[model samples]
Target: MDDDIRRGDLVAEGEPEQEFNPGIAARLPRKTVAGGALVRDEAGRILFLEPTYKPTLDIPGGIAEYDESPYEACVREVQEEIGLALPIGPLLVVDWVPALGVWSDALAFVFDGGILDQPTIDRLVLDPSEARAHYFLTLEEAAPRLRPSMARRLARALQALTTSRPTYTDFGR
Candidate 1:
């Protein structure tokens, strides 16, 4: 191999060298991305979903698919999980959840789902394949039933709602 021929560089034997930016292929921090919603009821209670596969309750959202944005994923997940097509609002919380050795670290975005009326809530059809049921509970009542990280994210997202600004947290702290 010629000294001019570096690894990852493409060239024909008699053709001029072609340049490629190595940085373009630089590795980025490995983190899974997820999106969630902070839906509320008319009486100021948060809505939670009980997934069939998880012990703890969860918000209505899921892992973003390839080429999907967090907001888009949030909307899709809400419809898929709860049959709600309500427009998702601005971001409320951007949380970085640390890995628990069982999975990769994740960056989660929780968007404001606005408020739902009793009729709308009653109309919700929970997708049994993904979730068993849904409940509207005050944060205090929800803490024990939710993942600790999720409880923290809820607190942060509520604060964001009150302040009308986005909040950031690490490991849901």
Candidate 2:
């Protein structure tokens, strides 16, 4: 992984240049693991959440606490974020986002989850600081709505589910 790190720019004679690189500092291992379900409703729409600060939509999951397991974190996050009770099962994807400088390594475990029969749309609650709104979309509709990285990740996950193939991972795990 250290090989992935590289120098940013060159310094002129007798001049010191400020270094700017994605991997300049030692990358810390992720302490907080998270998971989310790429759920499709009966109407064939995928569930998504619009974050309060971020312009793009995302799956419902966040950082896991030190004592919490990934599955527990998933269940808790879904309930806290959308007021839904879901049973999480199986691991889907474990991704790393090196560009997020602060929390550089994020282990995202996507799962096949159980959905509630009744919709909790009206009763949905949002953490004012975390989310703004929520919506559902079909693959055809969502492709254009997501940011480039999100779109690619979703596409890859969906393709893996469709083809029963394993996904590529940057981390050794």
Query: lDDT score of model 2?
Result: 0.65
Q: Which model scores highest in TM-score?
A: 1
TM-scores for every candidate against the unseen true structure? 0.84, 0.67
Compared with the true structure, what per-residue lDDT tens digits does model 1 show for residues 132-168? 9899999999999988888999999999998999989
Error of 2 at 35 (Å): 1.6
Question: Measured by TM-score, how close is model 2 to the native structure?
Answer: 0.67
Q: In candidate 1, list every pair of residues with a backbone clash.
A: none
lDDT (0-100) at residue 5 of candidate 1? 53
Q: Which RMSD values do the candidates have, in order?
A: 9.7, 12.4
Q: Model 2, poorest ten-residue lDDT window? A: 1-10
List the candidate 1 regions with Cα displacement exceeding 4 Å: 1-29
Per-residue error (Å), model 2, residue 164: 4.8
Candidate 2 residue-wise lDDT at 50 = 83
RMSD of 2: 12.4
